[model samples]
Target chain A: MSSITSSKKHPLFWVLLLIITVVTLFPIYWISVTSLKSPVEVISSRPTMLPQAPTLENYVSVVKSGFFRNMFNSLLVAVSATLLSLTLSTLASYALVRHNFPYRGNSLFLVWVLVVKILPPVVLAIPLYSVFIKMGLLNSRLGLIFVYQVYTLPYCIWMIFGFLKALPETFEEAAMIDGAGRFYILTRIVLPLARTGIIATSIFSVIAAWDEFLFALLFIRTPSLQTLPLVIVNYIGEYETLWGELMGIGLLTTLPVLFFSSYVYKYYTQGFSVSLK
Target chain B: MTQNKYQKSCFFYLILLPAVLVMLWLTIYPVLNVFTLSFFKYNYLSDEKVFVGLGNYIKLLKENLFMEAFRNTLVFSVLATAGEVILGIALALLFYGHFRGKKSFMIIAIFPMMVSSMVICAVWKTLYHYDIGLINFLLRETGAQPVGWLIDQSKALFSVVIIDVWQWTPFAFIMMQAAMGSIPEEIFEAAQIDGASYMKTVFSITMPILSDQIMLLIMLRTIDTFKLFGKVYALTQGGPGNSTETLSYYIYREGFSYFNLGKASTASIFVLLVVAGISFIYIGKILKKD
Candidate 1:
């Protein structure tokens, strides 16, 4: 439609794009290199752009210090929380979209859920701590899995509810006309259709639970129960700088999240756009 | 069809019952407990639960550290939220058209957002180290004196803000980009055919269409940044002095570190009110839009 502007692309645009790309990736690149550097090269007076002598010594030591166990702990908590939230919220979101309630509208329920979701995790920590202690849930992975529903459940409900709302009522009505019950219609029709939203919700829940630090730090006093974030922060508190090992574990911890995010990048963006709608 | 509406209601409620109960116990109960705790001079360590009836609130409001933390949270959130949304929009605009390597570039840009805050801070903390740090190394090479990135209290909050911007700008960018991408290319083409310049097109056409997503992004980032804890915990630990103290960090210290449950509860209530107020404004805007 336009020839004049399209005819000549400015060099400055390319320059800016190049700068943006580099600035975007430099820290990740630097951390990756730092993680691979030998101990001598790590604390050297001069910064090394590339590792002088690369070594796995840092990763080895990090693993030796219950790092894998911590990673496993994070995995257990995040997966459990995601699964639990998704299961409950899927059923709840379905009922929310398809049926009418006696007292309040479904949208109001969503608002209530969003409000709870937004409460700062720190505010919940002290009370939850005392409760968990009485319930014998402190320093336990199961406790974190349960408590993390505070974030994950509300998110799943709101997000999946958005997805369910956008689906046509005709298909479900047709199923009902055939004498299909609500449970059968939901499992066969709604769940299959909302798979993308379900996947996106799962990814979001896992990320929230994985990145959670304040609650884990407060509730899980047992070192063995510490999650990856806890272990990384423990590196800061217990030892010297140890930037090499720190970066090594840091890089490892981030890889799974990066891959998962990139996988659901499309749905993640779509979910945001849908929520705004 | 013969089944009563009551049974239908029961079925729906039964399905929702588990999540509702869990959320109620987790959210409402804890919140009310925190509210009740705010009125007492409770210390978990000493097992003291003397009723103070707003004494904790008075004490916290009068505490210098609490005031500093509140101010720091406001400054950090305002700056960080503004920087992220603005820069995010700019970046989204810059990459408006099809370009080489655009897909990979988008992914790379958001990598920081996907990574943990503590990890990012760990990397940045090393970079901000006084000596033998990459930033200082770069400064010395350019014959410029190395700046105290974290050590100097005055610059510390700004440093943390920069990190927040770096880590979160992609979030705003992605949301904006997704919104911008939805507008038909024909709209932009029509604007171009009408002899509109790039700046004119962006301000008049692009931004107006993307404003809803922009509002959403601002609300999300503002609430998230106001609850600043992981970065402070990882990087500054509320700092060389009270320089980097945030409301969340302040609450953490009072509740966990000091075990002064009443002061922490009071501080938590303050944070809750402020956050709820900000969210209330945002939700009202959303409801109006809908």
Candidate 2:
């Protein structure tokens, strides 16, 4: 506090910080402008700080096509994966924390889930493709949902487990003394008590599922089933003309995520900080 | 209604049973399955599975493209990881002094990171467009020619590396900032009184104190970077003649595009070894600390 108070009197530091902030943010700002610019303005040899005329043409084109369908696909996979992973990871972590069981040394089996995070998706692609093919889940939204669980489940467990450890055991015991069943206690007591952690976990899961690309690219091939991230890239060109629409779609895809986080950023991103440390 | 203690324990294990099974089948089974396929030459559509005994491994070792991918991955990972960590530290330092705009500035700084990697890549891909990119536009104002951003074989990997830095530097920043806040300000004050300059204080006092967190960031970043599928898929397509082909992209093409399970599996094992080796070190540290 003292250091901060003394340092603030310096004009140079504030100016330098402002410059750094602009450098850090220039790309996102530029993209936003590009997405809003007219076709001619975007492709013009000279760059314009402001668009010649802002147009929603790219946004309209994307929406009129399968873009909504793609967003829907992303929605389906992300929600299903978050719900499934949360349920399983919560139950598993509950069992670990509340019960004494045989083979408990493998309490570390949950630790192995982090292994999936490290295992490259490419390695999983070949065999998982076969597995899903036999199960008839390829190109299905459920397939990517199932795959995303593999990525997010470890996080869910480790995180929820941290919250459970921090919670008082007396509440669960009190419920047990009242003749409440384990299932009832879990649903009513543990779940309710862990609300902040669960919500944080879910938000993180949603972002992960939304942003996921490689699996969606491989697993979902149909235009309707493709996720937003996949479709946004499809409209872009390697040698190209219009930069504006590309920027617009890019901004569109990221807008909801930023809003959701700012709304609950304290709970969600902060949880990541705790779990990571 | 008197259940034995052992029976209650059994019930708990039973509750855990389905989850364990699913995770095993989904994660572990595929890993082992990839292992089995690595030694075999299974055609994409064929019913026959021929075991070729280290044949694919031999083929990869002899292939120039495989070596190039291995080299490219290491270079990209090292540079990208280092860039994010260093940049993260610098940004964290920027926020050390109290400023009215620090909070808004941070949110904006992390904006690139919060968006989906695919979306960010789409934006950056346009910015890197040789003809119309702002980067080139800026360069031209100084009388310089447009730099080859993504199109040229030589600069393609560099462009991808730059995107990774932009997206992930915030992660490093966030982690380090959290760590920095925890370091008792008094400790920093004592170093200041000991006649340390700002740079000396950070290099000696701040960095050494935050080394563990920095290493943790490096580990986390490495695992994610090793997965490097999004940007490459979005940007290069392993192209300008496969100049930017990475291991994950190679495996993806082999497995999904070509349906060449054998080589894909081999490549998968290669990636697994690299990641697993790094993880073992971290796991050991975590366990030892416990």
True-vs-predicted CA distance for residue A221, candidate 1, Å: 1.9
> Any runs in candidate 2 off by more than 4 Å, and if so which?
A1-9, A237-239, A263-277, B46-48
Q: Model 2, residue B264: displacement in angstroms? A: 1.0
Candidate whose lDDT is highest: 1
TM-score of chain A of each: 0.92, 0.91
lDDT of 2 by residue, B1-290 (tens): 45766666776677667668778878889989999999998768665678999999999988888888888888788889999999889878867755676667667666667877877787788778788777898899999988988989999998999989988887788778767877888877787787667777788888999888787788888877777777887788888877888898888888777777888898889888888898887776654643
Q: Give fnat (model 1).
A: 0.56
The models' CA-based lDDT, in order, is 0.85, 0.78
After TM-score superposition, the amount by which residue A36's alpha carbon in candidate 2 deviates from its true location, in angstroms, is: 2.0
Q: Could you give the C-alpha RMSD of every candidate to the true structure, in order shown? A: 2.1, 2.4
A112-155, model 1: which lDDT tens digit per residue? 88777677889888888899899999889999999889888888
